[model samples]
Structures are given as C-alpha cells and as structure tokens.
Target chain A: GGIITQTPKFLIGQEGQKLTLKCQQNFNHDTMYWYRQDSGKGLRLIYYSITENDLQKGDLSEGYDASREKKSSFSLTVTSAQKNEMAVFLCASSIGLANSDYTFGSGTRLLVI
Target chain B: LAKTTQPPSMEAYEGQEVNVSCSHTNIATSEYIYWYRQVPHQGPQFIIQGYKDYVVNEVASLFISADRKLSTLSLPWVSLRDAAVYYCIVTDRTGGLSGKLTFGEGTQVTVIS
Candidate 1:
C-alpha cells in the first residue's frame, strides 16, 4: 500500500528552457529509475539511482540529469528542452536488484514548444 | 543486458484468453523474464515475472520455458479495458547494484467486443 507521486502531470516549456520533474515514492524502496516514452513507442531508460546520493546514466541519459536527494524522492531535469518535442517521463522504484518488482508513477507529460 | 523480441501487435476478443509470447534466446542464467503492460497515457504496469517455470499472480500468469529462452504471458480474460501495449523484458545484470530493465517495442493488443 504505497504510492508514487509525480508532480505537474502536464508540463509545457519553451525551446531551450530548462525544466524539472519531480517524483516521490513512499515505498521506502532503495532503487529508483527514470524512463522516457514517446508516442507509440516503448519505454527507454533515462537515469537510475540505487540509493541515496547515487546516480547512474541510462541509454537515454544525454541532455538530462537526475538526483536522488533522499530515499523517498528523485528528480529529473532537462538540460535544454527541444522544440516540438513531446514525451512522457516515468519514475519507478524497487527494493533492490534481487527483487525487480518495481512500482511506477503515473508520469509527467512534457511538451516543448 | 539480454535482448528480447516480441510481436509488434496482437488482437483478442472479450472473454478470451490472450497470450503474448516473447523470446530471449540470449538470456543469462541469472536473468529473469518480466511482463508489463502500458495503457495509453499511463506508465507501464508490472504484471508478472518468473525465472524458470510458471508463475501466476492475481492479474496475469507468466510461463517460462525449460530452456529459459522463451516465455509467455497469459491474460485469463480479455476486456476492452485490457487493451494496451504489452512489454516483455529481461533483467539487466550489467551494472552492479543498478537493476535496469530494458524495454523494447511491445505487442499492442487490441481487444474487440
């Protein structure tokens, strides 16, 4: 009975502007992840954190940065928004590698105009 | 990271059993097969996972082959609300402590009434 909360479900940003997305999970899980999904596409890894203050780059790590400030919260920042870019950013968390049952947040829809 | 291959799309009718198959011929011994479903405008949701043999949960069932190269996810009963893109993935043991799951283009299941 835990919840992953993603702030600002819909985000609109101008080209070249920096945007930040936040994710908070009350599951007390040790690992957190960020993924990006385009329309009609599968999910792509962006960044992941194993524990607090740990950061690891994923396949789609370019142009984005992630932070695991605390065990309950992880945040993602877009270095520079791309014009006409639209995608959904998802956040997920799990206990550890041995147990891969992850809980994911609804997502933050990003639109760069 | 083990590569996975699954059908791009599938069709099923309401009240019918829907099974989606995935092949991971290069799966390692420690890797596990996982099934996830993504409804439109939502994050991917975990269905079931298994290492070898069969595993079932309240939502779905996962059957892995003895060779561990192929697996199938079965939805007991399909409905209009069950229509979504289903993803099959294998656990990534490349990064230490980073439990990354690579998602490929999943099977889009269209449910008919």
Candidate 2:
C-alpha cells in the first residue's frame, strides 16, 4: 500500500500573506485533488488535476491555485490569506476517475491571523 | 452531481452499532454513493462506496437499497476512535476527466464511553 504525505502539519500566516501546501503520493494515481475543510463543515473541493501539468477548478477555487508538477506531487497555494481564517487543507489521490476510491493525506492546518 | 442530506449529529455508546443514513433523491444512474470519515484535525478517509445492493469492506459496510435513493453506512461496533464527521458524496462516473465530488454537511458521530 502507498501513502499520501502532506508537508507542514500546521501553518500560521498573517493576513494577505501567501502560503503554499505540498502533497506527495506514492500510489501513482492519475487523479489528485485538493480540498478545504472548515470548522463544523464538510470537505470542499478546491482544485483537482487529472494528469501532470493539468488543473481543474472546483466550486471554491477562487482563492486557491493548484499545480500538478509531476505524477507523484501536487501543490496548493493560498493566493492571499484572509484574516481570521482557519481551515484544514487536505490532499487526496485516486487511481482513476471512474468509481475509484481515494486516499487522503493527514492534512495541513492553517491559521491566518 | 446529486445533492445529499444527512443527519447533523448522532451519539452512540461504545460497542453499539451505529448506522448513518444519507439521502439523495435526485441521484443519477451513473452516479455512485460514497462515504468518508474525518477525525478532528485530519483529512477525510474513504470508508466505502456502492451503486446498489450491499458492499462491505474491512473498515465499514455500505448498504444501498434497490431504489438507490438512499444509502446507509454501518459501523459494526462503535469505538471511541470511530467518533468523527461522516460525509456522503455522490459523483458522476461519466463526468469528464475531472470527476468533482460534492460533499454534504456530514454527520458528526460521538461515541460515549
């Protein structure tokens, strides 16, 4: 079994600051996803990539940018941090787009002051 | 993507069985029901998925009726570690390369000692 690793378990940034979260997967999956989770809310998809160098936006992708640098790595950047924003960013990967299961990383908790 | 609804929260005692139900009245034929769990400060973890009938895995069991309007996730014996937010998502298998997953509010299950 392979694992998905996310760097920087916790992040504290100032308002309007830029922060980046990195994810690496060893499953060699073709699809990678980035999601944000707020307190008392479910995960919301921000961006996803079907293949390397491909990007697709989701409902809440306005403030985030994603990059699929390689088959094994996907990164998300918070364009500008908002004050009083606290959320957990999660990275997931799936083998294929059709009815396949996804494996998720532990997550990176971000607190914007 | 079909919209899903689930209970806001639930409480169960240890060693008891917990069943969380999700409703998707407008689910499409090409869509599938997926269940995931998220512990505090962690990313969501895939539990199970099914189109119809019953599907069971080592971690959880997903039961879908013939009508496919609803699905249930059954936890055999509840434990403290099982306390978390459970989300039900529906995704269209035929959707283009980026198969976006929509997450519902999710049901928070608290296991009492």
Candidate 3:
C-alpha cells in the first residue's frame, strides 16, 4: 500500500496573501492532480501533471499555479488567497493512465480571512 | 466529459444496502462511469468504475444500463463508516493529465444506527 501525504493539513491566510500547499506520494504514480471542494459544490479540478515537470490546466486553473517538481511530488500555489477561494484542496495520484487506480491525500483545508 | 446528476442526499441504516444512482443523459459511447466517495475532512476516494454492464469488486457493485445513460453503485451492509458524499463521474477513455474529472454536488449518504 502507498500513501499520499499532504503537508500542513490546515492553512490560514489573509486575503491577497500567497499560499502554497504541498503533496507527496509514494505510489510511484504517473499522474497527479489538484482539486478544490467547496461546501455545497463538488470538486473542481485546478491542475494536473502527466509526468514530472508536465503541467495541464483544468477548468478552474485561473489564479492557481501547479508544479510537478518530481515524479513523487506535486505542488499547488494560490497566487492570491481570497475568502471565496477558501476550501479544502485535495491531491490525488493515479497509476499510469488508469482512473481506477487513483489514490488521494487527506487534503489541505485552507481558510482565508 | 459527460455531466452527471445525483441525489442531494440519502439516508440508510446500518447493515442495510445502499444503492446510489447517477444519470448522464448525454454520455458518449467512449465514456466510462466512475464512482467516488468522500468522508468529512478527507479527500475523495475512488470506489469503482465501469464501461458497461455490471462491475463488482470487494467494496461495491456498479450497474450500468443498456444505453449507458444511467449507473448505480450498490454497497451492501453499509455501516457508519459509509456515511459520506458519493460522487459519480463520466469521462472518455483518454487518460493522463488531460482526463480530469468534473464533479457534481453528489449524494450525501447518511448511515444512521
């Protein structure tokens, strides 16, 4: 079994501040993704990486940046935190191109004041 | 990507079977149905996926209709741990970073004693 670890489970930031969340996976997966979950709304994809250093933007990519520093790690940065953007950010990884092999991290809950 | 619709919430008792249904009226022939669940304060967890017919694993069973416009996830003998938001997603066969999922509000299954 492998684990996807997300650092600093809770994050608090002021409006207009820049915040970054980190994710690391030991599954040796080939694809990684970042998703934001609002209270009533479901998850929306922010960004994803096919491999190390390869990035792809999703429907909700604006105001957010992602980097796959290495095959085992992917990071997401909020360019400017806003109260409306405060939500739980989830990191997930899948083996190769298979969707059924997706494994997720605990998540980073962000709170912007 | 095919849009999905699910119930806003559902209630089930412990040891009872729970069947969550999803509708995708415009699902393409090349798309597949996927199921995921999210417990409070945690990332969404992939439960199952199917192309057509029926697919079953240790955790759940997926039943897809003939037209592939509808699917159901059946969990037998559900417990309190099963209480969570269940998501159904539809997407094409393409994988990698290009195959990001679009999630809906999902069905919140509350398992009561």
Q: What is the per-residue lDDT of model 2 for residues A1-113, given as tens digits with 9 covering 90 to 100?
A: 89999998999999999899999999989999998988777778898888899998887999888999899999999999999999999899988766447888999999999
* Residue pairs in clash, model 2: none
**Residue A7, model 2, lDDT:** 90
Residue pairs in candidate 3 whose N, alpha carbon or C atoms collide under 3 angstroms? none
lDDT of 1 by residue, B16-98 (tens): 99999999999888787888888887788888888899999899989899999999999988999999999998885455633
Error of 1 at B80 (Å): 1.6
For all predictions in the order shown, the interface RMSD in Å is: 2.6, 2.0, 2.1
Can you give the lDDT of residue B81 in candidate 1?
A: 95
Q: List the residue pairs that clash in candidate 1.
A: none
- Specify the poorest-scoring 10-residue window by lDDT in model 2 chain B: B95-104
Give the runs in model 2 whose Cα sits over 4 Å from its true position. none
Task: For candidate 3, report its TM-score.
Answer: 0.94
Task: Give candidate 1's chain B TM-score.
Answer: 0.92
Model 2 residue A5 CA deviation (Å) reads 1.0
Candidate 2 predicts chain B with a TM-score of 0.94
**Error of model 2, residue A101, in angstroms:** 1.0
All candidates in order of DockQ, best leading: 3, 2, 1
lDDT, model 1: 0.89
Cα TM-score of candidate 1 = 0.94
* Per-residue C-alpha lDDT of model 2 across residues B6-111, encoded as one tens digit per residue: 9999999999999999998988888888898888867788888888999999988999978999899999899999999999988787756335676777999999
